[model samples]
Target: MASALDNPLLFLLVLLFPLSAMAQTNGTISLGSSLSTSDNSSWVSPSGYFAFGFKPVADKNLFLLAIWFDKVPEKTIVWSAHRGNLVLYGSKVELTSSGQLVLSNNQGQEIWTAQVTTGSATSAAVLDTGNLVLLNSNSGITWQSFDHSTDTILPSQILDMGTTLSSRETETNYSSGKFELRFQTDGNLVLYTTNLLTNYLYNAYWSSGTAGTNSQMIFNQSGYIYLRQTNGSVHNLTLGNIVSTRDCYHRATLDFDGVFRQYIYPRNWAGESWSIVWSVPSDICTAIAESIGSGACGFNSYCILDYTQRPRCYCPPNYSYLDSSNTFKGCKPDFVPQSCEPGGSGEEPRPQFQMTELPNTNWPMSDSEGYNSKNEDECRGRCLGDCLCALAIFTGVNCYTKKLPLSNGTIGTGTTKALIKVPQGNSTSQFPFQREMCFSFLEQEGI
Candidate 1:
């Protein structure tokens, strides 16, 4: 596992050391007309909006090639060309006799460098759009920092979502934390545990929006990025709202705890910074950390809010407890699995779920697929008929099934609802009364 970036000092040290040599060119690199370096030492951008300079804030130790709001070294840094590596103090960016940009520390050790991935002897420039470009002396942008990003997602920067499963920690210190926002093939954003994945095949659609800056904004008017601000500019920074509201708290942020938050912005000043309008815990697959990790409900069960208990996990209406305990890991089907694997039968049976929410869910790591159906009834038929189908959840008019059961633990949040299909037992005419009696018994025993 990659280490998390929670220690800001460590983050700065690791990221700055190698970056001191940024903008030092060896082969044949040069700067463009629109840009300039901090001390006018050398490197420049194409539009004069950015500069290759040294910053003392992250660490007083070394200089780095950072893309800031502009010439102001203190401005919000949108990107860092090299954040991890040690550059000796007093290192200056010098064009190597080879034309490559090299940073030689006080002792002459090479720190961070920008090498041409393709073309050679190219001129490097920073564009007004905040892009650092490396172009052939002939003037073609060969490589740029805009193509890659550290943790901060800037405007106009294209993000390839859903490609990586884990997410970087928030900006407190710059270390890796929890929380991950991924892209679905269908262009939706899904949140899951950095580690645990789901078993379902259909992709989870948390929110939908355009791919770039037109939709996602890092800073807004209200001073918060994740939550939508009532006083700030009105635009979807990350994902579009599935529902609308005035009193609603809607924030979209990759939070410090390593969890993405689409929460309610606190409207009351005397109150909390903003009570949780909506939030997915950092851990989304296993029942480890408090309710923060994923799959808190355990396998084959769904976690839900218990109005009376505040944040306890509950089995869905149709589901039963796998264990005698009330903990999420205890949930199981009222009915047992017919067979473990798929039979040679014509087609497999389909399972179905009713209306409910699935909170803090990640993609199940198992090899599974989803089946599209017209409605819940259709989904039920599919899972029931299939021998291989174990558990299923219906969302956005589609049914998702798994060979392995899904994590069942859940925490509170209006977001935790989804219908699932489970096997039903053959009950007699008095089944309803019997079920009610059993439920009463369990409730009294606090099962």
Candidate 2:
């Protein structure tokens, strides 16, 4: 009932409360439901591009650490934690004994971590630019996940491809997957496959120039990364432009959910208006070039740009057709899976084939099981013998195989050699997607 300043003891306690809370935090900025705060139980970022607290999407146990534009009503989440995994009530975000910012729940078990470090003294601060920094008394960043990204690349943030693996395996989930983005010596942004240990992902250029230009722009405030040939060039490479083809203009996130996107603001009250510039399913049939997904061509096929909107799926060169339908039925070579059976006949022949682009594809189930091969030939031999192996791909002198022909939905063009298993009746020449096959009808209708 007494005024804080009038009560010196209470005033000092009030002042000390924030300091104590900060000390316990070890200087890591967090966003989420402030219902867990000891004070007013409200979470707010300094600049407001982000907020802390509970969201209503998931079940009750779900606690999310998310980021979105402060001004926009849609408040699109750029990053999310505990997506499917949620925490129970009574669990609070706290600085743990190990110096990591942990989200602990009622049972006193940790659900998540900021993973910050404290050498001398710890302090967490949310910078005006939206960067949540956990600083040592000396102002050094002991640990930061900014160096590690999920999918959304923010402005002023340097995307050191050298530090991160290539592309997301899926769109929404955050787990390590196949492709990755890299900074090339040529200064172009390239998407490469980590499995191949070479450049399998394609490139999006920022400017026509050399690499290491300080002129490139990554504005965290704007949530876009850009490139300029010179200082403040009129036209620059923007994240929106490079990735808009997928209809993922603003609602873009790079996690395991297959590089999620949205052309229009789905969260907007007026309804999202979007166009697909690049998308796996959207570009599957029509996508050309090596960096698209495997389905760009039919399974066990080469995507030939020679075909119109329907990408031409061709047999790998030298590989005889398994299906006599030849109208582009999935390409199969003379060698059957058993021909190269490890104990049977190890003599597999290699030949030269011409392909302007490789399909973006996923790893075979076998490879995901932790199968290690000495070389491509060994992998090929293994695939041939497995009988379960449906397709084989050799890249960067390494080989990978799957149990089924690449499908229109799952295949991409980002590999060197992809051998798909084709059914005798199916033709690679047939349009992979039903939509593509019916494009003629749409055109007839003035679509």
True-vs-predicted CA distance for residue 23, candidate 1, Å: 11
Model 2 lDDT per residue over 1-447, tens place? 669989999888877665333432433443321245223232345644454444433445544454444434655445544433445555566544444556666677777767544463255554434355556767788655355455555444655424343333333323345544444544454443333344354433112344655343343334344554445552233335443212222433333322223233332245433332333323333322343344333345544332222334445433444554432345544444433334436655532222111345443422422245546566555555556665566664566665544433234456555544443433243224345436756765777
Residue-level lDDT tens digits of model 1 in 217-259? 3433232333222345434433444333223233344543334
Relative to the true structure, how large is the alpha-carbon lDDT of every model?
A: 0.45, 0.44
Instruction: Give the per-residue Cα lDDT of candidate 1 at 252.
Output: 43
Question: Each prediction's TM-score against the native?
Answer: 0.39, 0.47
Please give the RMSD of candidate 1 to the true structure: 16.3
Worst 10 residues of 1 by lDDT: 27-36
**What TM-score number comes out for model 1?**
0.39
Regions of candidate 1 where Cα sits further than 4 Å from its true position: 1-48, 62-64, 71-74, 84-88, 94-99, 103-106, 160-172, 184-188, 192-447
Scanning candidate 2 in windows of ten residues, the lowest lDDT window is 350-359
* lDDT for residue 429 in candidate 1, whole number 0-100: 34
RMSD of 2: 12.6
